[model samples]
Target chain A: MDEPLLRIVDVWKSYEDLQVLKGVSFELAERDVKVIFGPSGSGKSTLLRCINMLNPPDSGEIYLRGDNITAPNVDLNAIRTRIGMVFQHFNLFAHLKAIDNVSIGLRRVKGLEKQEARRKALEALNRVRLAEWADHYPAQLSGGQQQRVGIARALAMEPDVILFDEPTSALDPELIGEVLQAMLDIAKAGTTMVVVTHEMGFARAVASEMIFLDDGVVIERGTPEHFSVSPKSKRVKRFLNQLDVLYGSHEKLLKLSEEEEGK
Target chain B: MLFQTELEFIGMGIVNSIIIFPISIYIMRWYSKKKDMPHIQLWDTSLKTAYKVSLVWLMVNILIGILFNTFAKNITIYFLIQYYVYMIIDLFIGTIVVKSIYKKELGESFMFVFIIQVILFGIGLIIGFITVLLLGYIFPEVSDVFFFVLEFGLFFTLLITASSLLIGFAIGISLAIMRVYGGKELHWLSSGYEKLFRGIPLLVLIFIFAFGFPGLFWYLESLDRLLASVIMALGLRSGAYQSQIFRGAILSVNPGQMEAARSVGMNKIQAFRHVVLPQALRLAVPGWSNEYAVVIKDSSFASAIGTFEMTFIAYIWGLRSVELFTLSMGVVAVLYFLFTFPVTRLFGERQTKKLKKLGMGGG
Candidate 1:
């Protein structure tokens, strides 16, 4: 690919004694949807959090659009303005109404006027099909609706790349579809995205490339079909096998036969 | 003779009854409307009117007593009749005026009733004076020290209670801020201050500050014993309790709010101003009111310091006349109730409403 829109090189992060990410490396072209897949504790979420400095890597270089974000001289606020993050817990400001929550960063950080920021907020909410809930507080909305507002808030910043750290992980089973559908809409709009999720079907359907992580390292990175059909690393194979047992596979009989024989 | 005396008492009582009762009620009703009714305004107005009426009646009774001693030989029965009569008349007139205003289609014009009451009461006072003068000739010597104590004592106590509460609130809120946001050293200092003050009985705290502090401080030795000792002791002790009220309020603010504000490019001070302090201060109001009640009652500690605040003044004057002591204490008790009872009630109700809105109240 011509120069990648984003490149993460040998990124390493730890929290005290626990090393969560170990020399993780990745690259993304403009408008690519990269899905990171792994069992829980695989550091997929922490890696995504590191890209935007929400959890800055202890040692790594993350360049966005040719700027070295990991460099100490880079204005992190300015960098954050161009890189948006959606949290797993949907940490929307509890006291603010949906629209105000979306507009807050715009008005305060981007210097948008109240009316203009609200208009942009409405537009972002409309993109997520949550325009009707714009004036309602988070407490008044359902979990799915609140997640959508969170997405709207992230989108209002108009970042170059969106990072999602298990966006639907905290959502109810029935509510998961609504948040995923909103994410699918974002992907269709052609924004660059990096998502850490256990949702294999979404990975299979939407991701241009998939990275399988285990114990803080990327074990396999390939096309979704390649990973699904013929994962090279034994770790990837075993991880996918366990996921198959948990979710049950939709793959053709050949893969099932292999899985059963391996079991 | 008993029938004639009772009839004359009842007859003279009518005018006094009308003047006192209606003015009190009308003032209360008018006050209630301005303050959004059934809340602060209601209590403030009623208490204010009660104080005014008590003061005016005290002066009138004392004057009448003095005049009777000079001009009429037998004024005791007349004074007793006047006291009861004026009380009844004031109640009656207050009820009529309040009810009339309540029934009127005057929109917001009800406020004018306060001005009208003052004007009417002034005219009524002149009329009452003339009537009393004419009646004095017939009834003779009908006002006494008992009447003077009732009126003056009530007004004096109300003034003391209200001033103490206001001062307490101001000191309490400020000290609370100092306790909460005043740096690590200040926080420790304020915490110690709060514990020391709130831990000690309010009476002891007041006494020590009022009596002990002055005795200990050489510079203060030359100052007026009563003024210096009482103000310093009461104000300092109040600051300690107020600080606790504030600290609790500030802590109640969510830490998330401060983080959110900082993420939005606000500095620590701006974050506190915009997001944290406003919500914390609102939450602290009921607690602050409780501390205010303590302050009002605690002001009585000034009496031990030898300040001639209401309780002290009453005690000094009461010692000479036991009747005055009973009347003075009654007036002071009523004044204290007027100052604190309604505030506590109002804050309690508002706190319930706030809790309800926050989804923290009853199931």
Candidate 2:
């Protein structure tokens, strides 16, 4: 096997007395899509956040291309420049237009020139199919449009990996499809990604590997086929069954997955 | 039978009437302009009114001068008319110049006209001095401290206002930062500083810093008397109000903003500088403008410590010539309004525009 692009080992995290991620371990090959799914408070989001040191694990080791990012000697800023995270809330700068929001971090953090950063930001926005809305403020844009801008902002960095923390979770149902379609395009373009989402259909379609977590622990890990059809753990089976009922038809769920993959 | 007053009293009353009537009209015209009356209309009407009123007053003064001369002693209506005409002309020219400059462009032009008026008025003083030199050949005991105080008083007020704002902004921003992001002890200290200074009346704070703090800092035995005390009091008191303005602006920033900045690889300081503080400061403008107006007005308290500020000089002149009190106070009031009123209005208008842009204004 090729060397993993990212490696997490023995990661432990807590918020005060409440332990959120318990001794989790994971690895990702270059350009892999890894989807983590669980019910709320299952620490799936916490795990993705820890990878970029947004919530630094209490005791853990995180390595990016064999460099120990969790070690004190490593420059977290240099590490962060290569890793981008998209938030559930679409945290675009309210004062800035979409293009400016994308360009600012590139200019300030990566030290890109104004014209060069702006050009790159426009390219990223175009890639997300939001080129027309570049001049619009976050307040002016729809939720889906804002999320696309958030993705464009992250992509402008040309990060080695993108972390998505429930990206479409905050969107209206009709708007969620647009954001998810953007994510599907990103996955097809072979950007390494770690996404924490409850979108089971999205998980089954794009993810090269699926992790099912419960109670701050990874309860099941397998390919989409295994998790969807004959999940070995009772928790996995029960979760998929509940989703099957909510979504109405297993065939519809399969079609949704196929549509995302075809995209 | 109706005029029972003594000849000297009647002459003084005529002099007082000549000074008071024109000044009152000037003030009323100024107030009307400030209320945003059309500049052309304001100028045209006030000029006509001043011309009519001054004509009637000049005639009355001449009649009084002749009558008083015939009854009690010899009097010179010539010198009094010369003085009155020069002043009315100066006031007319100053008003027109300032109003025209104000109408041309808002900020720097108005300030330029105001400064030119001061210089031209100073030249008027030079004319007075030369006239005094000519008159001293006849009357050697004439005093001129009153004119000296009037000129210096305007300059001193501008100086105090500028210093208060500069020093206030500096201390205020620093204290605001400490209050927002400092460690536990520093935050408490900043909060305590704001609370203590803002709670007490500005005059009380000035008194304490001027009279009381010196005893505490007496070991530093080289402090200048008025300068040290006034600067200390004004800076500290204005800093307290400024900090609150800053803190409120900072709080008004959305929480998601900080999180977004942090997620973009900025540390706390970088996030604040790049993402947070810029927006926060924009929000702070209206509040800071109010604080600025307060600082300008409160700087009058410097007079209590004998700082030779505008109000203090006005007081000195008022005490010497009781009639000059109303005139001097009016001058000080005009100066204060001139300093703060436009800035307040500009900030208020800008704030309204910002709200409209944000789509947060009324639907």
Candidate 3:
């Protein structure tokens, strides 16, 4: 009700002839957990990237708190420091150890002293349960551990909100749970998050709202229960059904449906 | 020739095989390990490989034997017998190495070990010749010729090589960074410099620096004009080549590294300085070592302008007599080998291993 923590108003982006995000808008309040998912080439990842202006929208307004981030002459580095990003590839600095990867943003962008930055980085790593891996390089760490380090990197920045662009998509199936669990823990700790993911279990467990984006526009937006109970659009139903067949529906959705059959 | 009679030659052949077999096998083992040859059963495929390699060796040895016999008189019989003995021992050693240590399938192991044995023999023959040259057992007429070239030539050759490589590498990396990440104008400027320098031959460039620049600039006249000109020509030319090496190295680094740095809220310059450049430099080391060797060889070109490097010194002393000229040139060739070979092996191999450990440079 009181000013949403972040606001996106009709963001439109394209690459040459291809329109990736068209008039996509969203709002997130404090401590909210939002999940965006759709079929491949649905512009879910592009919309998330547009939040931090990693890929700036062609025409749109993105506001962080009350400041218009999309406006010209805004200090992008400063704005980026406040809007953290976790990439699908877990792009940890190849040359640096886990601690350095986590602390680089703190020291460079936040202007924290080395010791202070390192101390905070370790704390963030501790949250992801990877504090012991501080000395290891990304090449030495497993996929799950590397992604956790990536999350720690963003968490150490203490940003206004974190954007996760398919954080577990690049991971092996077995490794996906640990990264999702880290995200869940962050959500429980009252962090504001906008995640683009295919993990239905994670969506059902923590997403306050689930959005289905198609053809660069939000097709459906509702509570997770609302989608499983009754999705308004046939397109949304078909897409979610395909995802369920491929990745399996969440445990709660199965139980909810079973209860409905009994009734 | 070391043994006089048939009986003595037979005894010496046995003795030589005993001594050389272990050394040959040791080298083969090292080569196999370095090649990462997988252990497998031995095969007979190496028979053909061995025969092919041995045939080449025999032809080369016979040719040399003919030359020696014709010129030195009656050395042919001894040389031919020695070559046959060495060839038999080499095949014997190759079979043993392939069977025991190489662990590759019989055919492939034989092929590999046989080829390696030929290389070993070639190296051994070269070492024997060089030792004879240095000990003055052969070419006693110009025994001091090597010392003469090395004493004076080493300084100028090193000066030109060191100066050019340093200057070239510095400008090279700057140009590489500009070409890779700079704006359109900067890219054009860097690329244009590369094309201009790379297009001109090193000798012509040296001439321009030596003659043209001195007339126009005048400051070059204060220095040793030839030495400064040689360094400038070689260095600027090397910069163009080294720039390509570094640019390729930079391009080889994963693009994700740059994206990661930028996503951390570092500006483009900050990201490049901290993230992309360090990895790119490591990747460039092996390529740059080749550049070092190139500059070393090109230092010989400075002789065209009479800067008195090893090649020029070889030329001056070589004019004394026909035989002395041949011996002097041979010594200078050895000296150049000594300059380039060890550094390439030590720097290039070790850097590759270290980079591999860091999971960089595709090593």
Give the best candidate by DockQ: 3
Candidate 3 residue spans exceeding 4 A from truth: A249-263, B1-143, B215-223, B361-363
Model 3 Cα lDDT, one tens digit per residue, B1-363:
542333222222322233343355545546656777565123224433443344344333333433433465343465645656756564665455545644435554554655566566566555544754676775565556765665456556766887899899899999999999899999999999999998888889988988776764455554468888899899999999999999998898898788777777899888888888888888888888888888998899988888877899888898978887887888888877866775576568878887886677773
Please identify model 2 stretches exceeding 4 Å from their true place: A244-263, B1-158, B199-201, B204-229, B306-342, B352-363
For A54-125, candidate 3 gives per-residue lDDT tens digits of 888999899899899999999998888888889998888887899999998888777899899999999999
Best by TM-score: 3
Docking quality level of the chain pair in candidate 1? incorrect
| TM-score of every model versus the real structure | 0.62, 0.68, 0.74
Residue B99 shift from truth in candidate 2, angstroms: 27
Native contacts retained per candidate?
Answer: 0.07, 0.40, 0.51
Considering summed lDDT, which 10 consecutive residues are worst modelled in model 3 chain A?
A244-253
Candidate 2 docking quality: incorrect, acceptable, medium or high:
acceptable
User: In model 3, what is chain B's TM-score?
Assistant: 0.61
- Which candidate tops lDDT? 3
Candidate 2 matches the true fold with a TM-score of 0.68
- lDDT at position B27, candidate 1: 65
A best-first ranking of the candidates according to their lDDT comes to 3, 2, 1
- The full ranking of all candidates by TM-score, starting with the best, is 3, 2, 1
Candidate 3 residue pairs that clash? B39-B103, B40-B103, B41-B106, B42-B106, B43-B106, B43-B107
> In angstroms, how far off is B338's CA in candidate 1?
5.6
